[model samples]
Target: MSAPLRVLIVDDERLARERLKDLLAEAGDMQLVGECRNGNEAIAAIDAERPDLVLLDVQMPGPDGFGVLRALPPESPPAVIFVTAHRDFAVQAFEANALDYLLKPFDRERFRQSLARARDRRKALASPLDTELLARLEALTRRPPHEPERYVTRLVARVGWRMRFLQVEDIDYLTAEGNYVSVQVGKQSHLTRETLSALEAKLDPKQFLRAHRSFIVRLDRIEEVEPLPPGEYVFVLRDGTRLTSGRSYRAQVQRALELPT
Candidate 1:
């Protein structure tokens, strides 16, 4: 016998939202406090209700799931379990050390497994630091650094004949454009001269992750990581553009997290 687990559901798709809600209902012991279609609304709900857990979707119109998590204060943030369809984005999700994931068209068992993991993670922690954990949680969620010893002091991208400097913290995500890598910061995009592989070596693995063969993301700025069909995952940043993840690198990304030995 224990207290009913309070939960919130966030997703952009109406059907997806309802389906998850139904799944939670079947479990019987959990309470469905409410649902939101986007991250902005979800954040408001989180601020007001302060639920114990959030079944968050990676992609949405504004303030996607990751955005909601980022916006949360460290003092009392909720445990997050992502419900997505993208396989590539799994790397990012694993980086976050997510409790579990329920792929789309979820069955009873998958849903149950997700809830079980969430419950276990919640129970394992002696005390929760909502805002603080939210801040540190990015380390586990974004692409890990290349080596623990080295961190990105500053982001340098080769452009044409000159190199431009941007703080690593300023970048939202890195995208591959043909033979180039794009530094996405806020609303502007800057071109860099590097292939995805070469960039991986130069960029710190702890802060930047290779999500897809062509895409790498800054851990702190990721707004959402969603699952997609045809064997792939997609991620959306705070800027509202969606990108795909690389399926092959999923395991490598997971290993970088260096979870409990």
Candidate 2:
């Protein structure tokens, strides 16, 4: 009979480590050689235990999972399956040729799938470690992929001592007051700590527009754009809110609203 696959669990959370340990125990073909709470300990444990597979967490206090990978000598690094909560790291993890990227709150079937991949790699390759892949992984760790600018999908707001989550799509407009902006979603309004310019930059330009210096209205919510005097215009919302456009932002607003210049 083939020997059991040696495995190591590395995570910052004690409960997370314990949970993985229990799951590993259920995998009859795998053996838990060691466990590490943080990246520093993970490095030491990897060298000492020489585990065949590492279930590594990406985020940690010091020397993250990537750091452990960087510190390892090229001789024979163990196969890695990155365990992370954030989905943003998925692409890079797979690009590094990881056994699998297991997102947190995963089921037993998911865990087994990652374990099977690790076992398959161990049997297929002469050396479980791929030095070239490690090198590429290190490079990626140093200069991680740049996260593209993303619009706000949801906004957390305070309502009479209770907190409420406001969906961006549900918002009709925003009114700037000093350093704070009142997010108007339908009939209700909620305030958030943000500047108009800062909030504008974070919103989808196609969906929203700076209708006025103090007002930002959802383009789809505009009932009509009423031409005021001398190049200025007032945007009438579907819900009957009228907001005037700023002189400096006239061209962009007109273009966005498909108004004739």
The residue-by-residue lDDT of candidate 1 on 1-261, one tens digit each, is 777789999898999888888888898779999999888999999999888889989888898666776577544457778888765565555434355666676787888888887676445343323456434543443345664554445555433334466667788776554455567777556555456676677677777778666568876565766655544556566755666666786665455533222
TM-score of each: 0.48, 0.48
Cα deviation at 221, candidate 2, in Å, is 47
RMSD of 2: 20.4
Q: Which stretches of candidate 1 lie over 4 Å from their true place?
A: 126-261
The number of clashing residue pairs in each candidate reads 27, 0
Q: Best candidate, lDDT-wise?
A: 2
Q: What TM value does model 2 have? A: 0.48
